[model samples]
Target: MRVSGSGAGSMWLQLLLSLAALWLSDANEPGTAMTTRDINQQTRESISDYTVKGHDLSTSGSHLTTQDFKQQTEENISNLTSAVYSISIDGFSSAPVEENVILYSPANIALLCSLTGTSTDSATVNVTWKKDNERVESSNVTINETKNVLSTQYTLTIRDRNQMGNYTCVFKSDQEVKATFNLQVPQIEGKEHHVVSYVGDSVVLVCKSLKYTPINWIWYMSNGSDQVAVNDSLMPDKYIVDEKYANITKLKIMKISEKDDRSYWCQAVFKLGESKGKVSLKVLTYMTPLKPFLAIAAEVIILVAIIFLYEIYSKKKQMHAGTISCFFK
Candidate 1:
């Protein structure tokens, strides 16, 4: 599904023209108030003749979960990859499958799991999602349009260990169901660690979460706005995130600045949930190194000055006593 020749040229030209036309429309409008219908008309006119050669514009697959796009590779839409996905059948499964998820203790995070079956056969395919051997209602799951390949998504917003285990997506067409994905969020090992570093120095904050299998590692300041993830968009010389292994990811701050003195969190993203650790950064100002030495020198000088004054006072007292003795004699 590679685009070449006149088709590619036309597509590129149409894209550029559409962008330029939109920019002009916005620029020409005084109040920047283009109605929805007007904008729709403009878009229609911009690509009236534009067309793709081989792709069918009307066909669509699934209602892509956020994870799907995250997992999809950047390839031409025309090229189709082989269907190598797994589905976990409940008690009926012949063998055990491993689908373990590690969840971090945080709010507003969700777990997305999908069961898909792809076949070229004419037999219609369907899938049902179940938790602990009981049939789950459609309200709890999202089912995609059925065709040659059928898929369903199960999302868990609230995680409770008591209610977890043996969740499965049973496919109707497959006799031997695929693999397994466990739903337990493993516990994070060890305790919170404290790291201290100075300005002009580099420090790496290590984060080892449950089960070492992390899809993403995010670092953010503990300011109430810490929800946004830290990435290369931050100053390239200052912040970096490196993953040493499946369970270990570290946040390295380079050439620390005064603003770097703040609380940071290392959040690990997984299919089941997120796990995180806290790091406290204390950046010493440039003058901090000199304070100790300066204090010691000041103390010695003060002591020497006091000793000199006492010696002078003692000699004066002796001389006065001898003068009084001579006068009396």
Candidate 2:
């Protein structure tokens, strides 16, 4: 039967919704969809001295944080002071107090400097921020004090080299306490992200670092569906071999396909832990209109719907002969 007027529009709307739902359902099917997210974020945050060479892990004014940084600063100062307090008492007197101890992490990209202090008597301490021995009246500096714990943090724009310098955190009470850190933007390492390739074209993804080298490479599709062990042994024309005295791990995907359009990770397995780089492939267009499974599903659904509608029409036709009326509603 021909669909017309409001009824036809309503049916079309429902059909579109159904098709959308079916497309979403395919996301759950094995080997169908790649997880669409910022795969650049490392899942394993459990890091040792984070290292990021040339990129900021976050946007402007966002600082990597640590809870109880004051306590850590105190402990660090105490440890260092205990070892050489007697010898350097006169020479290191101007050294800033352990206001805050922000351990540099190369894995995370962010410019962070902090100050922390504690007072058991009242629950707060007077504090001030500074950079290059000047008073820090800039609104960009953020200060927060909780009960007896006080924390002050400052973050710079990603890769903003001029903004990086000696930052000093000062705490004042009956005595003046100061801490200073010379934060600088260092030369970076590792492949940032995104190497595009078209269908039937080959691509190479490189993952390396200056400080360390990987023992082995583990390759996995970001969607979590396929994980192939990378080795020199030939497998379907894809291969990975140790390059540059086992410093760099390179993966070559031959004759890429639309299915290859997703983020791929090359995890460098080191003795201590692992580090990875996220590389994505972009397929220009598909050789065929729709994937095999989606095409088959659409045909099957169309046939089933036509058969159902025919059965309903036949039943209504028979009922009408007996003076019965029927409607879709």
1-329, model 2: which lDDT tens digit per residue?
87679998999899999999998998788887755442333432322224343234556667444545577755654443111010111111245433222222222222232333334232344656677778878666666645544456554332233444566766565555566655432211544578877788888877765565455567655556765555567465665554755666677888888788888777766543455667777776564546777889999999999999999999988888656433533
Q: Give the TM-score of candidate 1.
A: 0.44
* Best lDDT among the predictions, by candidate number: 1
Q: Considering summed lDDT, which 10 consecutive residues are worst modelled in model 2?
A: 82-91
Quote the lDDT for 309 in model 1: 97
- Residue-level lDDT of model 1, residues 1-329, one tens digit each, is 98889999999999999999998998798988778898899877654534223223333774454466556633323243222234533422345455664343322222233333444342444556666777767565665644434446665443344544556665555453434445555545543657777888998877776545667777777656646567666767777877657688777888887777888777766555655677777888768989999999999999999999999999999999999999999
lDDT value, candidate 2, whole model = 0.56
Each candidate's TM vs. the true structure? 0.44, 0.32
Model 1 worst lDDT run, 10 consecutive residues: 76-85
CA-lDDT, candidates in order = 0.62, 0.56
